[model samples]
Target: MTLYPRPDVALICGVDEVGRGPLIGAVVTAAVILDPTQPIAGLTDSKKLSEKRRVELAEQIKQQALCWALGRAEPHEIDQLNILHATMLAMRRAVAALRIRPEWVLVDGNRTTDFGIPASAVVKGDLLVPEISAASILAKVARDSEMQALHLAHPQFGFDSHKGYPTAAHLAAIAEHGVLVQHRRSFKPVRQVLEQGGL
Candidate 1:
């Protein structure tokens, strides 16, 4: 695919998110404004990068980019606002937190936030845009780190292994240990499990 370059270079920001489908923990979003002249090599979608590579690239993106910021929507907030809305909220927060006000916003997915700036929503944008890819890496790494910390407190759930996503192992652990505060009760899988013998 021929990825489109930013139409305008002045303060162009790219946005992407992580952990939206997780059954536990907060959803994270990142917005990054890159230096059009100095591009970071090996920047790509977070899903395409290894954990080690993602860590390395995130550091590089942070140090090399003009500015970047991460935002999160907690489990309670996700439950209250729903995933789609919460994801947009996180995206908006990320963009707002950036040190520079962006002229154009390129988002990783179809949803556009109310940033009051001109924005474009590109499907699978993280794969196509360098700045979006950088944002994706940052958000993924940050959320993974947070989940690792959660694993220490809730060892029974094995949050580190599944990263709060709804996998068979994570579901089984939830079934055995019962719902913790981190579990999103609003999620159908969690709600179903809770109804089944109070697991």
Candidate 2:
């Protein structure tokens, strides 16, 4: 892990969210506090890594991080609160779930919610901060696993392949198979389909 300069802070937490754009499932967030002594190599943005690498790194992170927690806002919550607010809610929950309170928090985005701690939003932080990258990988792997499970239950929707994103295939599947309970009714494509009585 790349050591960041934090003058008196011993516990620094990194935060990130995944699945915000997906039409189904929850918006997942993760908080990670890395152990300075347990450095994890090859940490970077989850999107920059292959699926195999991400899965491998995710395991390492779970085993090695000082403390880590995941939080999520379900599809119903996403529809009620909107993606932005729901994402913030998830982030807050992630930090709250952490066993160790961090002296400082860094979020991987341009905006951060009130974490009730010293927190800053770093644009593309997952690329620059190892802790944020670790959170990103964990959130992604968790969400993708949810999608894979959803696929097994409803393979017609292709959740495993597209991860519930609003891809053409996913849209077509919704049109043909109707909306699943897992789909977010607030999303444009899903809303359109529902309005057209496609569900």
Candidate 3:
């Protein structure tokens, strides 16, 4: 790991999003400015960690990070703006909601909006950057919790297990129950179901 001298740099928040590929629910993002004095061990991309580990790290991040905030684009927003634009909207909101304004924004993916702040896009940032990793964990855990809640409301969709991804089980559920209000109408699978006259 290389040394990052914070003295010369402006406050920076690492940003990342989850649920872009999901068939239902909102796209969630998080921006985190980690406290340099309170370094967290074992931070990595949320997808690389176990669910239990991600949950543990998420709590630690919330407690120890200098500032953190979550933002989201609801299903209707995704349908209206398309996934890519909706994701950028969520990222912008995450930055705006931060307690401390970041002089620089480091986003996980290779593309992002200006957000009226200086921003740089990093490929695979969630894996290479600690701040991005923390953001990834927070975003993932929050979205997963939302999926669990949706599961409670519609256990037939198996949201708790598949998290609204287009798994065989999930597709079958859509075939049986039809698309729910939360389903992304612009997504191919859901659109196909709707085209077929639905359930």
Candidate 4:
């Protein structure tokens, strides 16, 4: 709680990722440098908030934060580099794209990536840190919007509802309709379907 404006550091960025478990689309990440002067209320892990609230907060964060940037690792990159490494790559890209350079970074989760700056990994940071919470909201909102777009393109997959997760309906869709380029080929369900010549 209250992990910003350290006695020594001024600009601190929060980092978080979304969509690591999804079967389709990219792993998206967000880096946020909150404007401590403009404190945001109702900040928490994105999963804890309603989609409507997350969308509202995402817009507020984008407008109020000192700087923020989004990054993503595509499905092809996820297959080539694996989810863990691809997530780290996405985190790095999010930070690198920031308009304002952060003096220190606080990333949610147990692991931290090399952002060429001082950084620490705060477990459950999205709950404890406002910055990370903002990042989580932004990342989730962005990725969910993508899933909605994918739904428009491939309505049979029900992407709008499942957001490309390995739900029973999604697996059934893959089984019946075959995998789209958006599906991560390395994922077990997709791989199983492909190996069985389901495609």
Q: Top model by TM-score, which number? A: 4
- Ranked by TM-score, the better of candidates 1 and 4 is 4
The local lDDT score (0 to 100) that residue 105 gets in candidate 4 is 90
lDDT of every model, 2 decimals? 0.89, 0.92, 0.92, 0.94
- Candidate 4's displacement at residue 1, Å, is 4.9
Residue-level lDDT of model 1, residues 55-119, one tens digit each, is 99999888889999999898899999999999999999999999999999999987687899999
lDDT of 3 by residue, 41-128 (tens): 9999899999999999999999999999999999999999999999999999999999898888889988879888887788888888
RMSD versus native structure for model 4: 1.4
Candidate 4 Cα errors over 4 Å, as ranges: 1-7
Per-residue lDDT for 89 in model 4? Answer: 99
Pairs that clash in candidate 4: none
Per-residue alpha-carbon lDDT of candidate 4 for residues 69-184, written as tens digits (9 for 90 to 100): 99999999999999999999999999999999999999999999899999989888999889899999999999999999999999999999999999999999999999998899
- TM-score of each candidate? 0.95, 0.96, 0.96, 0.97
| Model 2 weakest 10-residue run by lDDT | 1-10
Runs with alpha carbons beyond 4 Å of true place in candidate 3? 1-8
Give each prediction's root-mean-square deviation over alpha carbons. Answer: 1.5, 1.5, 1.8, 1.4
Q: Which stretches of candidate 1 lie over 4 Å from their true place?
A: 196-199
